[model samples]
Target chain A: AQTVTQSQPEMSVQEAETVTLSCTYDTSESDYYLFWYKQPPSRQMILVIRQEAYKQQNATENRFSVNFQKAAKSFSLKISDSQLGDAAMYFCAYRSQSAGGTSYGKLTFGQGTILTVHP
Target chain B: DAGVTQSPTHLIKTRGQHVTLRCSPISGHKSVSWYQQVLGQGPQFIFQYYEKEERGRGNFPDRFSARQFPNYSSELNVNALLLGDSALYLCASSLAGPTGELFFGEGSRLTVL
Candidate 1:
């Protein structure tokens, strides 16, 4: 079984600054995917960025990027130039690569970190 | 394109009652997954269906059941609801391919009294 953990229960960053949300996971599989999702006040879960375990290069989506340490089993999300709109609950997720249709895209999520971008 | 959509934005149910929630996948998406999010917690996987077949199920009890339709839409049914069952039910959809990202809906909030 794979499990994701976000140690930080809450985080705050000043506007125009940067914030990094920590995430760690326990998985025996070598091939898998890591994802960061954001849920705003509207309660809609939005994909932030994704990292493929095979790819050593961290995933970057504009201001949102990840420091993916596969060997350390850590995948942290970094939001640069944070804005007020970035205030939301962020969740870290893990999914194993589908093999022979065995495990498709089931996501195991972390407890989540509540991020507040203060102006 | 419209993202995933869930019906009954909010629902109130009594203990031991039954409830059904619906989800419409994004256009062209062939996979639909269900998740439960309790207050102040992350969403937990409940079920996943692709091509109108069950692909994966979480550690939920038998009271929780779900199925996909020919149109790729889905329904989640929970019987004998308990206070512990009160949570936001979310629906996510993705293309039927390896390593595809999921698109989520606003979620249906269920409050069990």
Candidate 2:
């Protein structure tokens, strides 16, 4: 069983500043995927960024990026130039890669960290 | 392209009653997954369906059941719902299974009285 942990229950960042949300996971599988998801007040879950365990390089998307340290079992999300729209609950997730080439989309998610972007 | 869409954005049900939630996956998407999100918590996986077949199930009880239609639309059914079942139910769709990035719906908020 894989477990994702987000130690921070809530975080706040000033507008136009940068923020980093920490995440750690426990998984024995060598091939897996890590992800950060954002859920706004609208209650819609949106993918922020994703990183593959096998890849040493981190993943970046727009202002969102991940610092994936496979050896440390850490995958942290960094949001640059944070805007008010970035205020949301962020969740870290893990998924094991299935051999059938089907992403076994069953995700183990952390408790989540509520992020508030202050103006 | 349209993302995942769920119906009955909000519903109120009494304990012991049954509830059903619907989900329509994005066009060309064949897989649909369901999750339950309690207040102040991350969503928990309930079930995943692909090609109208059950692909994977989470640790949820048998009270939680779901199915995907030929058109790839899906429905989640919960029987004898408990107060614990009162939460936001989310439906997500992807190209395949969990390995891929999921596109999630706005979610159906179920409040059990």
Candidate 3:
């Protein structure tokens, strides 16, 4: 079984500053994917970024990027120039890339980190 | 393109009652997965349906069941509901593969009294 962990329960950052949310996972599978999702007060889950375990390079989506250290089993999300809109609950998720019979589209998520961006 | 959509944005029911939640996948999507998100915790997988077939099931009790329709729409049913069953149910859809990118619906908030 694969499990994701988000150590920080709450985080705060000033507007225009940068912040990093930490996440770690335990999985025996060599091929997998990592994702970060944001949930606003409106309760809508939005995809922030993704990283493929095979890819040594980190994944970056505009202001959202990830520091993926496969050897350390760490995948952290970094938010640059944070805005007030970034204030939300962020979750780190894990997905298996196995083929055939094990092709369930299930995502194992971590206990979310509540991010607060101060103006 | 329309993302995954769930019906009955909010539902209230009493203990021992049964409830059903519906979900419509994206136009070209053939995979639909259901999750249960309790307050202060991350969402937990309940079931996954692909091409109207059951692909996977989580560690939920037998009272919780689900099925997919020909149109790729799905329904999650909870029988003999208990107060512990109250949570936000979410439906997610994706292109039929293992890319791991999923579009989620606003979720149906179920309140069991």
Candidate 4:
């Protein structure tokens, strides 16, 4: 089974600054998917970004980018020019892409890190 | 297009009671999955249904059961509820394939008393 870890239980960043949320996973599969999801006070889980294991270029969505280190099993989320709206509970998730396996499409999530963006 | 939709946004039930949560996947999506998210914690996978069939299940007990309808909508049924069953039940939908990207619903908050 694959497990995602987010060591930081809570993180804070000033508005207009940059912050990085750490994430690591334990998986034996070489091909899979990694993701970052954000849940705000409204309690809605939104997808921030995603990274495919086979791709080394990293996945970026505007202000949200990921530093995916496959060999080291690390995938960290970087938020640039943070805004107050960026404050939320961020979770790291993993999914297996193995073609005909029982583990396919099951997402394993981390404990989540609460991000606070102070104005 | 409408995103995944879950009914009964909030509900409270006592111990040993039975509860059912419903989900309607995004249009054109043939796959739906259910997850449980406790307060201050990340979502935990429960079950995944594709093409009206069970594809995967997490470590949850048999007390928790789910099924998908012909319209791609799904329902999660929990019997003999425990206080530990209190959580936000989330429903996610994605295209039918090996893809991992999923669109999530607002979730149904269940409080077990």
Candidate 5:
């Protein structure tokens, strides 16, 4: 069994600034996937970014990037030039990539961090 | 191409009643997964179906059942519902690969009274 944790229950950032949300996971498997998802008040869960365990290069998507520390089992999301629309509940998720296993394809998610971007 | 789509955006049911939620994967996707999201919490995995076969299941009870059709559409049925069952039901779709990235749908919110 795997578990993800987000120690920060709430976070706030000023518009046009940068903020980072923290996440950690406990998994014995080496090959897997890590993801960040954002859910706004509209209730739509949108994929923010993803990091493959084998890849050391951090993932970047415009203003959203990830600092994935595989050895330390930490994956954090960094939002640069934040905007009001960035306010939402962000979740860290994990998925196993093993070819054949009972837990394959299921995502274990962390308790979300509600982010508030103040103008 | 439409993203994963789910039906019955919101509904209310009494305890012990039965409820069924539906999902349609992205046009070319062959894998569909279901998750439950309690308020103020992250979504929890419930089940996953690929090519109309059950590929994975979470720690949820037997009251939660789901299936995928030949066209890759899926349904989640919950029987003898309890108040604890009240939550947002989310459906996600992915490609054939075991580690394909998942695309989520706007969930179906169920309120069990």
Candidate 6:
């Protein structure tokens, strides 16, 4: 079993500033993927960024990036140049990359952190 | 390209009643997964189907069931609905490889009374 935890329930950032959302997970599997998803008032979950456990380098997508600490089992999402569109519920998710039918297309998610961006 | 789409954007149901939600995956996408998002909570995985076969299921009870069709679209059926079942049902679709990069649809809001 795997579990993801987002300690911060809510976060706020001024427009054009940066903010980081904390997330931690407990997993025994070595090979996996970590993701940050954003859900706005529209109620659609949008993928923000992804990090591969095998690579030590963090993933960056335009204004979104991640700080993935494998040993600490921590993956945090950092939003740079935050905009009003970035204000939403952010979720930290985990997925197993295990082969041979052990798992498939299943994502375990954290409670979520509500991010508010203000100008 | 159209992303995943769900039908019956909003509906109301009562306890012990049954409900069915439909999803249409992106064209040529053969994988469709369902998730439930409660207010103030993250989306929870419900089921995943690939190539019209059940590939994975979550910790939900048997009353929650789903199936995928030949067209790669899917349906989620919830029997004996409970108030706790009131949430946004989301449909996500992935490409032919690892299901990590998922495209989601605006969910169907189900309110159980």
RMSD of each: 0.9, 1.5, 0.8, 1.0, 1.0, 1.0
Model 4: runs farther than 4 Å from truth?
none
Q: For residues B1-113, could you state the per-residue lDDT of candidate 1 as single tens digits?
A: 78889999999999999999999999999999999999999999999999999988999999999999999999999999999999999999998765778999999999999
TM-score of each: 0.98, 0.96, 0.98, 0.97, 0.97, 0.97
The per-residue C-alpha lDDT of model 2 at residue A53 equals: 84
Could you say which candidate leads in DockQ? 3
Q: lDDT by residue for model 5 over A1-119, one digit each (tens)?
A: 89999999999999999999999999999998999999999888899999999999999999999999999999999999999999999999998878765545589999999999999
CA-lDDT, candidates in order: 0.93, 0.90, 0.93, 0.92, 0.93, 0.91
Q: Is candidate 5 or candidate 6 better by DockQ?
A: 6
DockQ of each: 0.76, 0.64, 0.77, 0.68, 0.70, 0.75
Estimate, for each residue in B2-113, the C-alpha lDDT of model 5 and write its tens digit. 8888999999999999999999999999989999999999999999998899999988999999999989899999999999999999999988775677888999999999
Instruction: Write candidate 2's Cα lDDT for A71-118 as tens digits.
Output: 899999999999999999999999888576443758889999999999
Per prediction, fnat is 0.68, 0.70, 0.62, 0.60, 0.68, 0.74
> Over 4 Å off in model 2, which ranges?
A100-103, B97-99
DockQ, structure candidate 5: 0.70
Model 1, A1-119: lDDT tens per residue?
99899999999999999999999999999998899999998999999999999999999999999999998999999999999999999999998885877546589999999998889
Put down candidate 3 lDDT per residue, A15-84, tens digits, no spaces.
9999999999999999999999999978878999999999999999999999999989999999999999
lDDT of 6 by residue, B70-103 (tens): 8899999999999999999999988755544788
Docking quality tier of candidate 3? medium
Ranking by DockQ: 3, 1, 6, 5, 4, 2
Residue A13 in candidate 6, Cα distance off native in Å = 0.9
Cα miss at B58, model 4 (Å)? 0.5
lDDT of 6 at A98: 87
